[model samples]
Target: MTGIASHPEIAATLALKRRGITLTLLTTAYFFSYMDRQILAILQELIRKDLLLSDTQLGLLAGFAFAIFYATLGIPVARLADRGNRVNIIAIALALWSLMTAVCGLAQNFAQLLAARIGVGVGEAGSSPPSHSIIADLYPPEKRAGAMGIYSLGVVLGTAFGTMIGGTVAHLYGWRVAMFTVGLPGIALAILVKLFVVEPPRGMSDAQIVAEGQDKGVIPPLGDGFRTMLASGPAFNLVMGVTITSLIGYGHAAFGPSFLQRSVGLSMIDVARYVAPVGAVCGTISAVGGGWLANKVAARYGLHAQAWLVLALKCIGLPLSFLFYASSNPYVAVPLYWVSLLFVSSYLGPSFALIQGLAPLRMRALWAAVTLLVINLVGLGLGPTAIGVISDLLRPAFGEDSLRYAMLTFAAATPWALWHYWRAGVLLKRAGA
Candidate 1:
């Protein structure tokens, strides 16, 4: 045994059964992460009423407060992942965030809740960068897109379960109980991840190096990672594209339930019931399909395929997002929402794959952290807050229908995001050629 396969723990992970198990466990951890992050969206209304909070404040809690620390801290944590045990980092993050999420149930005032949410963000900062690095090591370049796509399914599944479970529990036992219910399971998940998942040597999946028993690479300095990203036009555009996409996606996610309830006259439970299943099914299909399609295209046409695929999806999805918000009838609007979501959500796997593929092996986690920092800051930090402020501004004119139009206003960003994706594709194609 040599390289990654030489380590006793990693040797077990090389077995097909253990590899699949690791992927499943990591995906499950991701599932819990989103559930903790997103449960607030579904329960925002209840929380607003109970705590006497405004939509803007709620948005800050959902978006800015969490995103601020999450984004800022991710870079350093990812630097740790580059040189340390990624599995340990992920497990510790899972436990910390989960504990904070549970603490949210104990908050009696706005300040306390905000503090708890910030703690949750700090913990979650450690999750994705390491997970992405680990996944990149597990699968070779040719198969990475699809593998990433499968892992991305955790987003939709977590959102779905969060909405459904949070809505139902909140309706019955109040939002506090819903928070507690969703947060505790992640602690157990963390323990499992720490015990079972083995860290593969960096660049283990790069065939040329791995087969020659030289998979390990020196961890580049943090500044070098930033320079690598800044020098690559395609990578920068991809980051911009993802950041904009996240803006629209997070804005819609944060406000969509409220819009449906206010404009469509559905209850919170009704919104969850209808939106969760549709979003779950469509998001899963689109995420996996996008990765599979990008892989196939890349196989034939080369490195730019994922960016091209993302551009196409955004183009098709943008108009449907407008229609989804504009329609009055729930039946018509919900189906359109599903189609729009499918297109928007499809980009994750390909986008992550592109980021990892383009990055230097030593800098992959750091680059991922930097990309996430931008995405969370621009997207998660501003998206929901912008919608909330806009909705409040339009309330005088549109009354209860204000949220609907505000979402539509945000939806217009889709085309702007599409342009970035197109630019990214062109840059990638030029670079590859």
Candidate 2:
């Protein structure tokens, strides 16, 4: 009631309007980010055939090499976001990553391509922290989960569009052309974001942001803010839980095209045409719907909506993810993949919303950065590479079926992820709501 304006419904509607715009911009930025990152996956076989690289080498290129720069740089940039202008940071990052993505098309050697991917990663590291901070300022605590979920649709939609387009273009023209095509559009979007999106005053949504700061002239240093987050039991559990879940999600996302190519016997174009679009549509719906459901469930129960939402979604996802991983038929596999995407992807919104809700106004970016550091390092960095390593190791025993087993093993981790979510929920309860 305090934060709401004179006309109660009008205030709520205005809040939704602002949050929607923020989420839209964030999602669009993410769409380009993923497309640029994944153009190589659609082109994997061609890159391998043309570059004459092994699976292990490809894994490194896909996983650690990119993750190294992406994860490491997130903290420092996040620190800057806490202290400086986030929109400006995102705009520059967009241009840098986009230009590098286009440069990927020009690579003739493995090293050049690797360098280009590294550049893309470096640029991308700048995106999340600032975006997270912006979203926290834009939405109230109760709405954060749904808002974050909507924002995260960017991941699903981005992957869908990237794979769809990457596969088609690579099929028709070549992989190089596909990379250039996706990369160029982002530069323009970057300019638009810079020119149009205004950074709202921090702590506009929640009463807590101002309580965390602005009362005292003292600005909490980035390290102190990070330490505060790490000190919380709920925060620790939540970050770990999400990281584990991400391991399965990112790993699958990375190798899916290759799996289709090798096992399902779909060409890159076919993967693009069929799998990508389906994934995008399914994933977006699941993500958005999950948030809506979480908010509804939490609001009704008067509980920590985020914790309950994640627990429910992940519980549902564990079994579905296994079905998705094990299915051999493309018809069965594709639809099941959506269910899996829904379950895993749904958590992003709630988790992010919770983290932002708990964080100090000045530390929003830092909190996002810290969480990303753990998530990307453990999830993105290890997830794909671990699967690749396992697949290669098991190749002699499983033959072409090695990937199937590897995916199943990864899927097995989901139950454990759910356990962590439950633990986080308990901690949130102990933390006094």
Clash counts for the predictions, in order = 0, 1
Clashing pairs in 1: none
Per-residue lDDT over 190-260 for candidate 2, one digit per residue giving the tens place of the 0 to 100 score: 98887656566556676664656663424587678768988988888888888898888888878888887
lDDT of 2 at 254: 81
Q: For model 1, where is the 10-residue window of minimal lDDT?
A: 8-17
- Candidate 1: residue 341 Cα off by (Å): 2.1
For candidate 2, the clash count comes to: 1
Cα lDDT of model 1 by residue, 10-65, tens digit: 55456334667778888888889888999998899888889998888888998999
Task: Indicate which candidate wins on TM-score.
Answer: 1
Which residue pairs overlap in candidate 2's backbone?
A: 149-349
Worst 10 residues of 2 by lDDT: 1-10
lDDT of 2 at 155: 81
The C-alpha stretches of model 2 lying farther than 4 A from their native spots are 1-19, 208-217
lDDT of each: 0.87, 0.80
